[model samples]
Target: METYRGEPAFNLKGLAAMAATLLIWTGFLLSLRSGSQSVLTTTDLALMRFGLPALLFMPLLLLRWPRIRRIRLRHALLLMLGGLPFFYLIALGSHYAPAAHAGALVPGTAPLFVTGLAVVVFGEPLPRQRLVGLGVIVAGVGVLLGSGLVDLASGYWRGHLAFLGASLLWACYTVALRILGIGALEATALLCAGSLAGLLLLLAGGQVDSNLATAGWPLLWPYLLTQGLGAGIVGGFTYGVAIGALGAEKTAALGSITPALAAVAALFLLGEPLSAGGLAGVLTITLGVLLASGLRWPRREVQPAPAREPD
Candidate 1:
């Protein structure tokens, strides 16, 4: 086992990764908020959700076209199926739920799901400390929601369910990444391909369209820029890199901070008030994450082996 340590460089990279993840999510929230302000055509929403992913990934596909072509059809289908529900849920659920609530809940439960899946599917050991950590994090999220921390009372239960469903889909995606032997670059490319397929499905189902005139170029710009570039392209690439370097467990552990960060962003950007319950929840979640990452306690001391007599 690779024991965890406070390596300054790795820590710095972890922080950067967290920041990038937070920024990506923040951008998504901002775009979603903006999109909701007006009448959104299906095309506009699809473009906002997938345009950047497609554009950013195009060059990667071109560069590795032969390799991309060589990917097995079944594996490609699996990736597409895994990615579709996640994107669809977010797009639909945001219409009914508060962005802050969705933000807090999605990332908050993801680590727990990942941990559980690891144990069940991979036969990974469930350390007691990690379990405690997961409990603490869940308690924090409960406090955050139960106390109207993000005004979650305004959302319907159905919307919350949708977000949970989305999280599960995402968990499946993460696990698939591990099982499928998909590297960071290839995973990213596959994600883009999957997203495109989903978008096409949405279109086929009459859930979206491609006419830019209905959405208007002006109103569509922010969604395209933020969702496409900030969230889809840059965010996906950064997260893929983080997962590659840190492994899924630690990467997901580090991601536990995203909800708290989203809460902070909501306070500043969306003028959402920071309540006492919210603060407590943030603390609880943070502590939980520290515990889950095996960082709360002091490192074990390694005693040197006794000096041996000359052989």
Candidate 2:
């Protein structure tokens, strides 16, 4: 990977990606609130669970129309397969677990999974400092888990496990992006394509059906629009841009921010109380991510690499 010159700037794309991430974080909270409220019906939940992803990604299918002849079947299959478990696990887990717990657990563990995958699959080196940072992050997560906000015996364990499964699946997808060299747009498009396909299969199997009539446009539309636009389109694009700019490892490292952002959104929007332990864990994780990324306070001098010998 090529390193860009100077400090990383908050450019338009970067800003957009961050904004999209924030929106997605907010959307998760909103969805949870909506689920709690009588505002959402079973059908509305169904739409959120599946319909939104399909609608959000519908635009990407058009890319196959003109310039692009045919998407590589193998790549598309990989992306589709990688996304399936994540979508299902998250959708199921959110129903059982608190949004705050889900947010804290899922994104927090993602970077670690990515780091492990990089070492195992890509043979990428992990420096000692980065390993220590990873340890700190793990410790922070342990604190969050031990906070007693979630009940271990009351089926919440299943939800937490689901979120962990989804995190691992997402990590695999992240690694696939690097190994297959899929660009942001292409990867996003393929994920949408795969999601759409999986959703269709589920519907065909009589697992899910269109219930717009019972769902009503009032509740259904907002949920779908928010999830489809915010998480589906914008989230995909911003993440892609970030991946393009920062590479998979660094972009994945930035994922630690998602939980913090979600926590902040919950605090104000949902009036959720934050525990002292949670706050400390969040701060510790943030610091750990910065350290793992090798981002120092002041800019450091770059040492020149040894000259290569002629073959």
Candidate 3:
């Protein structure tokens, strides 16, 4: 790809892609919170997250099936580890923690994890701007959740830990997508297909579909659309493009906006009140994302050679 002197096409594309990912992710948390209150179970949500997308992307998988099959088991496992299991962990974690914890911890931890992994795995520079931005983002999350943390029960910590694990897995996913040179569409299709197998196994093991059974389809349909398509399919592919375009650190750092945006959404739509701390958190996170992403100080991106096909 050709480059401009200050702003480049890739940077612009990455920002657009990252923004879309943030929007979908914020909606995802909102959907999960709504489902927690409604009849949607983890299994129900998991199936939606994987099932429809699997069908939607089936053609891509079919066309690429022969090459996909040739992927080494470890590589396949790494790819699979990114999508379904990451979502499942967050869903499971919510059983113990409040929205504050999930919203704050999971995304807040992801940038740092991504940065660390990028350093160790890809040997990317640990830029000072990134460090400062990560610190600010962490502080923002603290503001967002500090009060909520005081009243946590024993089990909540488990959920907190799970959120941390989810963050780690997400970082791994981002790095793998970039280093492995997987195309956004290709990764989304393969991961969604793999997710289907996991969900089917759970179904075979007697997972209850009580939500789908008892709740009328009307209540669940909207969520299914959002979870199935927005967060499940589009979110993965867009994030992949971002990692490839923006590099892992900046892309992951941009994710800090998710909690702030989610909080803003809850405030307006759900009538949730934000404390002073929450307001500060929203501001801090926004500024942190700006600093981390270098949106203001845009740089020319060095384009990589064409992505190599997995043998």
Candidates' lDDT values, in order? Answer: 0.68, 0.65, 0.77
Rank all candidate structures by their TM-score, best first, as comma-separated numbers.
Answer: 3, 1, 2
Leading candidate by lDDT: 3
Write one digit per residue (lDDT tens) for candidate 1, span 104-222.
Answer: 67777888887877877666787898889888988988876664434555654656777778777766666555555556667777777667766777778987656566656777777
**lDDT tens per residue, model 3, 1-311:** 21111112347778789889988888887777677767678878887888888998999999977776766566667777777789878887877765656777878778889888666655667778878888888888777776565545556777788888998988777766764545788888888888888878777888645467777878878788779889888898888877777777777877877888788787776666788888888888878887776656446699999999999
- What count of clashes does model 1 give? 0
Poorly placed runs, candidate 2 (over 4 Å):
1-19, 29-33, 36-74, 149-151, 296-311
Q: Lowest summed lDDT over 10 consecutive residues: which window, candidate 3? A: 1-10
Q: Return the top candidate by TM-score.
A: 3
- For every model shown, what is its TM-score relative to the native structure? 0.82, 0.79, 0.87
Which of 2 and 3 is ahead in lDDT? Answer: 3
Q: Which one wins by TM-score: 1 or 2?
A: 1
